[model samples]
Target: MTSRRSFIKATTLASAGLLIRPSALLPVSSRYIGLQLYTVRDAMQQNAAGTLQRVAGLGYNAVEGATYTGTQQFYGMNAKAFAALLKQQGLVMPSSHYRLGAEKMKGADVKGTMLHGWDKAVDDAATVGIQYMVCAFLSPQERGNPDHYKQLAADFNKAGETCKKAGIQFCYHNHDFEFQQQNGQYPYDILLHDTDAGLVKMEMDIYWVTRAGMDPVKLMNEHRGRFPLWHVKDMDSTPERKFTEVGSGTINFKNIFKHAQEAGLKYFFVEEDKCPGDPFASIAKSIGYIKKNLV
Candidate 1:
């Protein structure tokens, strides 16, 4: 009984609406806020279950884990158990840090045999519903020379290939060390240029980049869509430049977040490696500020 013209108009409007991204319709503040468990490492080491419960109560809906591989357990709980715990707390672990073992450094051809226990690590990570497996740090021995970094980049590609098989991503988390120049070139540049974009991605730690006197926004512009994860920490305005709660420090998070699309940011985890007092108190303050100001 509807008029033909009215029906056509409705169809056209519906088709137009379909072209808009669903995320564009939501408020920016509606995005999920994740906490890196390392921020509460001490408490988590003492009582992971209790600490995670407190984290949930503090309003964090997602978490990034720091303990895996070495422990073969997530904060003392096996993969399945930990996944269940997360569901109970209304939290999801989108990413977790896993150190690249010595065996993994042997190169792609020998990755499977050299890297002992990596298969289990990947399997466990997938079981826990992790989307990204991050190479958290490079030990002094692993990063001694320029050649070492090149090898590391190859290893990262191999690791990424492994993660891809499991339906997960592989990423590298940086510290200021990578920015240090060796013979005129930065190791970070070597890694970025050498790795396969499809196989490996980056998890930029804004605090570390700032500490290295580099610009995060510029990096995002240079490597569009390569970074999907971020470590959201802040630096104090003091000359010494110490760690501070998010938004409480001098870092312009609002400005950095404005380039989220360019950085391929899907999630960011708040981290505070050093805290003056109770870690919980620090995280609470940081999250409160983020919600009110930066999102």
Candidate 2:
């Protein structure tokens, strides 16, 4: 049904795609997992490359997220520059978080200025060699109703399609809000039920999962390989919710990590909402415990 002009257009598109190398298509290694980096915000803020060297000294092989509040181009550095920095430090940025800002403030006009670039984000993530590009959090406006969920599912799928072209997957990280009840149905459930599992996946934060009074292992069992990422953190023992280093609290991480294979976990990152003392020290302790106990 296509005319010669249309066929030529399609051919050009295919040629453009073919121009990309295979390195753009796959990860160099599969076994190396990462950390989200926000977990040790303090250390990163203090010393960017130095912090990465310490993490490499630990068992961690990879890191996720990007920011350098005080250092050169920490938070707002271009993707190509940052990726080079990561490679220089002998770390892999397999994944990173991007705040999918609200719709009104997120049009194409807002890109590359107030917001990050749209197509350029994928291009940068691909340039940086990330296998996954994470839409890190949701806005309050997008968190209600089955219809809203349906729309979100559609958006995620669309985003995934874009990522597919770039040879990356898209993920949704969770807090407690998505689990809030609405219209006799939970929006999280609606997202799970409606979204294409292949296109849209999860990066569960175990601390928040437990804080929401849900069982991570049970959710893994119920989902059956849908979850491929996790944020490993522990809750404090007090009556009030607080972030604690790994193995310092009551979470049964051994049992959880045991379920890794069944959950099809591609990677995991350590994330702590807040640290009482030095966050880097806390991460070091957590990584030590994870190396000794969980891994």
Candidate 3:
């Protein structure tokens, strides 16, 4: 009553020079834009915990993993050891990629994929504290006909339903193979149309999608809300189509970010299976570009 507007102005000024409360600050870029550890798997192997620390030092607050190389477990350490290290570095793992070739589901002596030591794959996902379980790559054996993808879609539905019980989702990550036509339709079209919308969501690797000769943004629109995650890598300018760090590549990240919501995108992970020089330096550059330009 004495002067409400003046009092509010004075309060704002009092706090202007002071650090705003943590909750009051806006988030930096998309905090969910994480790195898939496979980008720097070799470094992690050299020193498990320290590698994660380096990734964190570069400003990544989250990670999506390639999971296990040799005996180096996902995140480059055992569950307990890795979890401790992640906490120290303020990192969270919202998702991970796992090989899902038919061999993984149908093994000889091992029963199933070595990574998933069970009769079922869904159970293995819950044990890891991840909400998203992705089918990373498919062997050529898994492709060929519409029936193959149909069956794969059906299996995905069943597995997705299995994960639902534990509050999880089953997703498929695509390479160029899915873009090939089967019968009259693209294999990806069949998979999308055949799979239960709720069961088989997509993890669109933008670079691969682009490499497959499709528009990433259009795919996001056509299958609205189907893509919950993305593998954020860039393609070199050369005709050979080599991989490069973000921004340095030809992908239009700024235009793509406009459709983030419709894509149902919850996380974006940097994954470069091969690199020229120090992978960490490349990732650092990618992070800097994301924060400075793409953010």
Candidate 4:
């Protein structure tokens, strides 16, 4: 594990010449912390309402949703009912991950037919009062050819347009694969350069970017306001670099957060893909750490 002194020194060095002031990086308010519902998938799968009650009890005022499409419901409840449940728990969802189906993209024009059920998806999201709809993943077939990403970019722009019409923003969430080279060019770069910045935004998964040996702070500096949402998880200090509760691992979140303004970060959600014990317990620990240290 990195010592506190060493971590502070590293952060100071990293921020040099970046125009990021340490004083401005302090946690401004409690609303910054949020729970990604995927962290407690098992609990949610069994009892969505009860699980959300527990999430709110853990001091989470905001949440990001993961399940919406397959069940055509938000955790077995209709959109209105689900929204009511969230209200009862005193929580609000700002973003939800909606998969971009590969089947829908085939023989579909970017403007009209690329996304199936997207209009309904947007309607439900609006009913639930979400501000952003995220395209969560890309399947192997969709990413098999290098040229496919260009089409995907066009699809994203069209999707963003659709989302904009409905008073929502569209975003893409990335895994490590996006940073890898394909035909001597990074797919992530293609997406960034090809897509319209105003139309499409990005949700940065810090864990995946770190796993790919990339620096989140540098990426933020490079992009300068493209990322508005973040997945805030930590990596254990083992050879495997497994998922762990936030602030109990090797990732220097304090350092990354110092550049939050440049990253355009408005909200962040804690996500632990795997945990040693109860997911709720892990989230509690993460929240405690964030409150005391990272925020």
Looking at candidate 3, what is the lDDT of residue 165?
62
Residue 253 alpha-carbon offset, candidate 4, angstroms: 0.2
Each candidate: RMSD: 9.7, 6.9, 10.6, 11.2
Q: Which of candidates 1 and 3 reaches a greater lDDT?
A: 1
Model 4: CA > 4 A from native = 1-29, 103-114
**Higher-TM-score candidate of 1 and 2:** 1
Pairs clashing within candidate 1 = none
Error of 2 at 56 (Å): 2.3
- Per-residue lDDT, model 4, residue 168, is 72
lDDT of 1: 0.82
Give the higher-lDDT candidate: 3 or 4.
Answer: 4
Stretches of candidate 1 off by over 4 Å are 1-29, 103-114
Model 3 clashing residue pairs (backbone): none
TM-score, prediction 3: 0.83
TM-score of 1: 0.87
Q: Residue-wise lDDT of candidate 4 within 139-229, one digit each (tens)?
A: 7766855688988999999988877776678999999999899889889889999999988999999999999999999989999889988
Residue ranges of candidate 3 with Cα displaced over 4 Å: 1-29, 68-78, 104-124
In model 2, the Cα lDDT at residue 226 comes to: 77
lDDT string, candidate 1, 40-147, tens digits: 999999988888899999989889999876568888898879877887787878899988777344462222121556777777776677778898887785686678
- Model 4 worst lDDT window (10 residues): 10-19
lDDT of each: 0.82, 0.70, 0.72, 0.81
> Stretches of candidate 2 above 4 Å error?
1-33, 42-46, 66-74, 103-116
